[model samples]
Target: MPQPGATSRILVTGGAGFIGSHFVRSLFSGAYPGLAGSRVTVLDKLTYAGNPANLDPVRDQPGFAFVEGDITDAGLVDSLLADHDAVVHFAAESHVDRSITGAADFVVTNVVGTQTLLDAAHRREIGPFVHVSTDEVYGSIAEGSWPETDPLAPNSPYSASKASSDLIALAYHRTHGLDVRVTRCSNNYGPYQFPEKVIPLFITNLLDGGKVPLYGDGLNIRDWLHVDDHCQGIALVLEKGRAGEVYNIGGGTEITNKELTDRLLSACGATWDSVDYVEDRKGHDRRYSVDWRKINAELGYEPRHDFESGLAETVAWYRDNRAWWEPLKQRAGLA
Candidate 1:
């Protein structure tokens, strides 16, 4: 793929968002061993969830550039792919609640946008196109973890769009012989995440001395993968994974919403009185777990962050980075 051992120029779509930004920052920081000499160009639309501030740390570094644009624009995507060595696509409208209210945006951005990128990458012969996806594509699981082969039964508009994109990415590999590697990862929690997500929403709400909302009985379970660990797993796939294969990246930790709420309450020194039980989200998946043995056995990939410590650090980050997140929350009416 990446010209065997040559230095690569990578195009990172949605690179200003939570997980994507972490991958770009890590690449510049030399965290990804095989990508020490990599040059990165970030293409992001800077939507409400995409913040330029997330890339501020790496902005001054050499071999790093940023472009503001939509992935659905074929002309722009084709022009951008002219120079890049590979693509790590993280672009999508990913909030489940928002997707439920209106699925059009998710359909256009996640499905159409992905098709646009794939078509361009295919034409340009871009190797090792890594499609960053979610475990929610597997839908609710009553028991046992889902392997990559499990049928995709997405329950929400958000997940369905992602599932569609995942298939499109893999299809390019099969039909056009494009180098597409797809990774479905567990729920991610870490810094720079938009406050709309559960962890950030709860942490930020409690920090403001406000009530935190817990849906239904708060028994829904999820595997929490830290952003850094997720980025590392993505790097391993981009570097060593085979084309047309799917990998499941997980945090190796499982917890229910109630347990997670308890941890958050303890972390912020807040009481259960601050917890407000909200109505359940529409078509909310009961549980999600992924079998990541393939990534481990093949690429030596493993999550480096333990859930407890990772959550602590994440809460501390939000506590310390108020100025960075406050404006975002206010703009999005989340404050």
Candidate 2:
């Protein structure tokens, strides 16, 4: 473990993606109080969701390095692990819809890739290995939030892959005594999200004067966590979290998809008339909520951004940064 004031060299996998990019930028931007002096090496596959433009802000920053590679490559992971003090694993195929269409990519990337990283980290004797996961691993909830102890019942292929990865990571810790911590976070929404998620997709579609797709009756509820808040929680876990333990991170706001759509329409200056009710996705989870009391009570983690203000700020970012997302949307054929 790195002592206080000691320079920490962290290898962040999938650092060019949505949540990973935000976390890396924030780490180098003095957003996390004591981590300003830390060095980061970002390893990304530059997949459709991984955009190099997202790291332009930190590209010139000292002590920051970028590498293009796949996490499933054990040789690459082993070489990289030698130079870093800690590993933050964020590399995964996470789109539910994409996984539904074809699960091979998700299984290979999320399961096999995580296993490769874990094996390399264990071999190198890394001090701390933080595996970033999702709340969807618990499947769905009817009325209450799921605690860390809840049995995983993943509904979608994406969530199942994540759950598998989580188990493998924890197994390494228990069997090999590796210092590993897992964080399962709620739905993350903020700037630079790849316009495929619900928040960004709706925001970008509405910005283009196009209709937004709403699945089913739009009554499926989800807890929304801002990317900034989620990053903060992950930082806390990296600093003080225990080994072989699971922590849930949530934004404390619960709203149905319809209610969320209503908010988005209002933010984008659109109306319900612009919403296109699409066919319900297969095996769609009704509601997902995580009980993050463990992280809150132990690490003093709490969401700093409320939904309304965060949503407005996010909308404004997309509105002003048309040059950033326009190309992405066009490439994805969403424009």
User: Residue 61's C-alpha lDDT in candidate 2?
Assistant: 97
Instruction: List lDDT for all candidates, in order.
Output: 0.95, 0.93
Worst 10 residues of 1 by lDDT: 1-10
| lDDT score, candidate 2, position 136 | 95
Which regions in candidate 2 have their CA more than 4 angstroms from the true location?
Answer: 1-5
For residue 118, model 1's alpha carbon misses the true position, in angstroms, by: 0.5
CA lDDT of 282 in candidate 1?
A: 93
- Report per-prediction Cα RMSD to one decimal: 0.8, 1.0
TM-score for all predictions?
A: 0.99, 0.98
